[model samples]
Target chain A: MIIDVSDPADPRLADFVGLRDAQLRRSEDRFIAEGLKIIERAFAAGAPPRSLLLQPRWLDGVLPLLTRFPDVPVYVGTEAMIEEVSGFHVHRGALGSFDRPAEATWEALLGARRLLVCEEIVDHANIGAIMRVAAGLGWDGVLVSPGSADPLYRRAIKSSMGASLELPWRRMGGAADLARLREAGFTVVASTISPRAVDVDAFEAPEKVALLLGTEGAGLSREWLAAAGAHVRIPMTDRVDSLNVATAAAILAHSLRQRG
Target chain B: MIIDVSDPADPRLADFVGLRDAQLRRSEDRFIAEGLKIIERAFAAGAPPRSLLLQPRWLDGVLPLLTRFPDVPVYVGTEAMIEEVSGFHVHRGALGSFDRPAEATWEALLGARRLLVCEEIVDHANIGAIMRVAAGLGWDGVLVSPGSADPLYRRAIKSSMGASLELPWRRMGGAADLARLREAGFTVVASTISPRAVDVDAFEAPEKVALLLGTEGAGLSREWLAAAGAHVRIPMTDRVDSLNVATAAAILAHSLRQRG
Candidate 1:
């Protein structure tokens, strides 16, 4: 079903309310997928939709995808009412509430050859972009630090172009996870700007590698840098402080791609 | 000069008004640099300062740099007043107005071994991020299509972390510029996700190369693609449609970096 809706304050529209409030949405159990494309991506990734709030114009396009989920409510409304309920301009007049998938297990990641370990790379867009890069470059998985931004956040998922839904990723428990990964025969290489760091292009590719990346502020923690098998730096012209986290991640992901 | 201004609409503060109106600022002869760090970067880049609008807290920090341009106005006010003047929340209570520097000449870019030619990459942040990547990866210079976003836009400059000011970049007159670049002995490589494109890692890079990038919405125009010496693509898995334009640029720049 397509159920009609006019009242912005309708109790059924609670999930769509204040969609712009990142803080409010963060503590919720379900993640919101905005726009027709992302909503479709969520469905493709087997994310069960709790409900969908959209305008009548989008009903025909979305109906085919909802065939498997007959129980999920499809709340149709006027553009004005949808905006009123969302408390923000929803992109392309569609939003889907989906059950957040369970975190990917370390065992699943351990079976892979290449991975990205993010240390406090907490910007939502950056995290999302990294996931997109990882997925595109065919990195096996990603592990975000405890303090990193939620990859499931709406903007992050959107920024990742729905890769967050498909990529195998989870919150890394702590720095100790690094030790365990190393013990499992994965070489941990940190991406740093330290002058003594080996140039990534010049470094030898290992059989199994975990590329460690850090935030631009403090860089990889001194402790984490020391624990890594090697520190690799992308050579620069000394004009910029550092590349944006996501940009740097893409370069590293490309450099460390698992060649067939 | 420390000039206290409490009113946002004061005629003397005309250069700093409505900083959020990107179109209005773009038409003017100067560009706005938001945040104290960018303001410092602007000075360090040797961009002439027209004026400065900042809160009193930043006065001491800015005064040392303004000794050479003692005549440039320094307007100080409360944070609230500064926000009002900017028509947005000013970054760390500072914004600098600098004379837009002259564009880099084709001859200057022709001398470089590695360059980037952006085709309608209109997003300011993407433009800035690409500049930062180019600067970091040692790309000699950048040439943007006529419709591309201004690298000196406030957000672009901030996104670039001031690399927009330091990096050698200029806008090309039209598609004819590409033909001219080819005549200048630069291999024009188009970056596309087209299936027929050669993988960047597999494609042999030329000694003098100008990588062509397109907008994410549409790949490079047929004319540009046809003109390219080679069409190279970064290998991607099936998860994401394509990498973000900036992310893709970084990968390509790193892959085709000018090695010493």
Candidate 2:
């Protein structure tokens, strides 16, 4: 279904408004991915598009993508209309709306030996980086805490190089949800800078392990650390205190996977 | 000396132009640290300010800072002039220009058991984050390879929470520098994603160790790996290939420090 609309206020374009809001919600449910390269990667990775909105100039470039998702609707609008619809300047030439993938269950995500459980990491870019690392390093999946930023936010998707769409991940409401992992034989390792924390290297990878990280400012809440099977600290120089949460998570993920 | 310059074209303010350009350079001889709090922290850390440039409204707010650095020139400019001089609008109310600190020698930087050797990691934010982690975790210092971005770049410094100014660090010219480290009894561990690389946790941290990190996209170069005493990888799942370089570096630093 190819529909041509010249108006920016078209009701069909509601999915792409105020992307920053979606980031705060911890869900990409109402977000859209822009650009041909990103959309193609998502499609190649088996992500189905809900619809395609594009300018006439992009038709030639987008026709090839349309062939893949034959049933997906393609909406054509003027450049001026798209600018108004997106509520910002977007010169990406093409955009696509896709339904957020179903949330993965703890069992589904924990099937792999190495996992990351993000605690209150609210930055979209950091979430994206974590997903990229997770996908790049072959981590099974990421379990994002409730307060963490949405991985599907436009900036995050862009930062992840589309890996947020490809990586296996799920969101947990809070620390209580994490308890189930331990019952399922996953050793929860909380990464912190506390004095009593064990060296990250000291932990031998168990049959299954979950690396927990929090925001850089406050670090992991004491409750989360107390619940962990072990508190892990990355050693550092006396002058510096902590690594960014995403960076620390990646290192720990890599370490755990190596041990496994 | 207090110089009141009504004109924005004064040549004395040349160092503050195109602040963004500082990040592109191989080395920034000087950079601005904005915000009163960060400037205070830098001063407390013994980083001398080269000059204090401020708006009239902030004159009283910054008078105390000037007392500590009587030798440093203090420039008061009108709000319009300061904005024009900075090229971009800054709302921090004041800015301080600081000369880049003298580079530390490899021996001085490697005084501790653990050190960070960043090889060509160009992102300023990543460099800053690494510095912050290095400082927070009590690492000795950072050694930057020739191609790496300057740690003193404005954004880098800000992202580091001003720790970049306080951290003991040096810049090595090339592979020969690694050779020098080896001769100095520092074990060089290059981080890569190669299947054959030993797990990061398994790599022993010698009394003196330099963890080598490469640019984010390409893992450690072959020459670097060959030159390194050991090639280590953060274990990750099959889907995720790597972590952000800075994150990887921090994890490595923390791990080495913990073991030490």
Which segments of model 1 are wrong by more than 4 Å?
A: A18-27, A77-88
Worst 10 residues of 2 chain A by lDDT: A22-31
Against the unseen true structure, what C-alpha lDDT does each candidate score? 0.89, 0.76
| Residue B162 lDDT, candidate 2, scale 0-100 | 80
Alpha carbon lDDT at B152, candidate 1: 87
RMSD from true fold, candidate 2 = 4.3
TM-scores of all models? Answer: 0.95, 0.81
lDDT of 1 by residue, A147-245 (tens): 888898888999999999999998888998998889889999999988898988889879899999999878999878988998898887788888888
DockQ of each: 0.87, 0.50
Q: Candidate 2 on A1-260: residue-level lDDT in tens?
A: 68898767778766655544664434445446778867776776677688888887777776787786678778898777777777666778688888777767766876667788899888889899888877866677888988888888777887777888887788887789778888778898888888688866677777788888889879988888888988877665555455666777766676666432
Compared with the true structure, the alpha-carbon lDDT of candidate 1 equals 0.89
